[model samples]
Target: MIDPTDFKQGMRRLAAGVSVITTMENGQPHGFVATSVTSVAAEPTPTLLVCVNRNVSCHDVIGASRSFCVNLLAEPELELAKAFSSSAHRHLRFSTHEWRALATGAPALMGALASFDCELAETVSVHSHSIFLGRVVALHLPEGPLHPLIYAGGQFDTLGSRARTL
Candidate 1:
């Protein structure tokens, strides 16, 4: 097997979009920053997946609630990304005015570049994480330019003006 350290280093070379996965349980909100969100299919249904470490506080909340919102962060949401990524800032994760409950009662980021409100359709346990397959029940795409926040090389980065057009 590849050494975990080396595997992490290799993954750092691949840029990933930043997102906040949020859910509400018993009227309380829980969230965590994730870069593992991916679209699985669009034919039979609009489905996406997110991998969450089993140890995160929100892991069980997401499972019990069976619903979540994946909010794709834009450049302006850097602070939000930081807040959700840290356990120390847990209490502040949903303190901002930008959150609202969408169709699934999950907390969605109001001005996010895109918010996928999903119902948990399935869960797959692998190693130390749970891969959640979500069926998109509702979506929100705010009208604006998209300047996505990304993570690579152990830090957050954003696209510069030099990106080449195809």
Candidate 2:
């Protein structure tokens, strides 16, 4: 097998947009910072997927809720990303920001670049993570230019200054 360390280092070279996957359980919100959210298909139905570590507390909550919201982060939201990703800041994740819910009842960040509210459609088990496929039930696209936060090389960065719409 490829050395896991080497594999991880290689992946760090690929800059990815940051997002927070959120779900609600018993009116309590749970989420985690993730770069593994991606589009699966746009035709037939809008579908996307997020890979989540199965051991995380939010993983089971998401599974049970059968819903989630993928909130795409903006450049100004770096601290929010850090809050969601760190265990020490877990309790503060939702407190620092304004949140609202769409169709799925999953909390969506108020000022996010976009929030894709989804219903859990399928689950696939992998070695250490579970791939959650979600069908878009609703979405929020705030009117503005895009200035996304990105992660690469073990650090958070932004594409705002260099970004241009197609």
Candidate 3:
């Protein structure tokens, strides 16, 4: 087995796209910056998963509403990511983003690289976090070439297109 610290460092080397998970509760909107959003399956049904800190406000809102939106952030939205990631006051962070409720009644961020409105399908609590699996009910991809915001080794990065793939 690898040493724990070494394992963590190795995992940190893997780059991940950043996203903001949003939801509304009692007319108040909440969101959090996350790098753990991922597509789980397309067969049977389209689904996505997000792992959230159990103590965060979005976590509670997701649990209560059973719905949420995953907003894939673009490279131009680094400030938005930082704002949502801040622990000072959630309301203030939410104020900066334009939000609208989808059919599922979840708040979806406007002008994202993409947005997926989802219904909470399953959850599993692990130590200090909860893994939420959501089934996609609505989808939107705005007109634009996406330059995704990325995170790796605790730093923000940008994704560039490869000419070889063109």
Candidate 4:
């Protein structure tokens, strides 16, 4: 049998770019830092996939709204990433940063490298997380310096990052 701890540790080895998944909750915004955002389909209809832990508040909001925006974090947005990553700052998450309404009416970080406005197309429950399949409704990009932020090996990383390779 595979030990869960070892499996989780191994999974962390896969480096991934980070994003903030946003949706509306009763006229307020709900979002969280994520690294599992992925492109599912690209032709006919563009689609994306996001995994939200069933336990998080954003999960319920996303379920209700059936819409969300995936904002790709830039390297300069590390502090913003840290803010959204914590539940304690959940309410304050939208305050410190500038945001604009996406076509889906979801919050898109003003300086994000890329933001995909999406509407929920399908959902699947796998273990503790709910996998949301989103149909892309709009794509937003800004003209600014971009340095994508990523998370791997239990730490946040940015473009131009140097790591020892052997």
Candidate 5:
């Protein structure tokens, strides 16, 4: 069998965009840094998937509330990503950043590249992580340009000098 360390090392090669997954719990906001978010479907109904480790503090609230916001981080929001990734600022995540609830009542970061407001449609458990099927109820996009944060090889990056468009 492959060791977990080696498995993680292999998976880290797959680059992904960074995002903050947030949900409200007992009148307070809870969130975590995530790179396991992706589009699932868009025909009959729009949906996205977010994989969450069940051990995280925000995990329970997300399942209980049945709503969340996937805040896609911009190039300049590296500090926010670091804060959410650490347990030291778990409870202070909301207070340290400015946010306002979206139509789903989930906290949306003020300067995110984009926001996907969703209602939990289903869940599939797989080992330590639970795959959440988020039915997109609303979305938020900045009026200006978008330069997203990229995560790979255990580091954060951006488009940098590269052109922003396709």
Candidate 6:
């Protein structure tokens, strides 16, 4: 049998861009640093999928409200990523970031590379996490060049290129 630890270690090698999934519940904002977000479809409507830990505050908010914003972090936003990733003292962490509500009433970061407001469409439980599928309702792309924040091998990195086309 394959060891779980080995499987985890192997999966960690796959690099992914970083994002913060945000939502509001009971008038309070909640967010979590996530790298498990992916674009699933772009057919009749844009769709995205995000896997979140079931025990996190953001998870609870998403479950209650069925709305969220995926904030694609820029390279300079490592501090924001670190703040949201902390499990201890989350309320304090939230106080350090500037946020505004999107069309879906989900909280979004002020200067992310891009932000997507979405409404929940489906959910499925998988082991320790819940996979949430959302349909895009609105998108915001701020003016100016962008440098993406990337995560790999348990560390945060940056994307340097600003070219839109390959």
Clashing pairs in 3: none
Pick by lDDT: 1 or 5, better one:
1
lDDT of 2 by residue, 49-94 (tens): 9999988889999889999999999988999999998999988899
Q: Model-by-model lDDT, in order?
A: 0.92, 0.94, 0.86, 0.90, 0.89, 0.87
* TM-score list, all predictions: 0.96, 0.95, 0.88, 0.93, 0.92, 0.90
**What are the per-residue Cα lDDT tens digits for candidate 3 across 1-166?**
8898998798889999999998878887778889899899997999999999888877888999899999999888888888888886555666776777777877777778889999999998998899999999998778987788999998888866673257
For residues 1-166, write the lDDT of model 5, one tens digit per residue: 9999999999899988999999998888888999999999997888999999999888889999999999999888888888888988666677776798988799998889889999999999999999999999988887767778989999988877655553
Per-residue alpha-carbon lDDT of candidate 1 for residues 102-165, written as tens digits (9 for 90 to 100): 8999998988999999999999999999999999999999999878999999898998667624
Sorted on lDDT, best first, the list reads 2, 1, 4, 5, 6, 3
Estimate, for each residue in 58-146, the C-alpha lDDT of model 6 and write its tens digit.
Answer: 78789889999999998888888888888765766567767778788898777888999999999999999999999999888888677
lDDT of 1 at 75: 88
Model 1's lDDT to the true fold? 0.92
For the record, the alpha-carbon RMSD of candidate 3 to the native fold, in angstroms, is 2.2
Q: Residue 9, candidate 5: how far off, in angstroms?
A: 0.4
Query: On a 0 to 100 scale, what is the lDDT of residue 163 in model 3?
Result: 36
Instruction: Give the poorly placed runs of model 2, Cα more than 4 Å off.
Output: 160-166
Error of 6 at 163 (Å): 11
Give me the overall lDDT of model 6. 0.87
* Model number with the top TM-score: 1
Ranking by TM-score: 1, 2, 4, 5, 6, 3
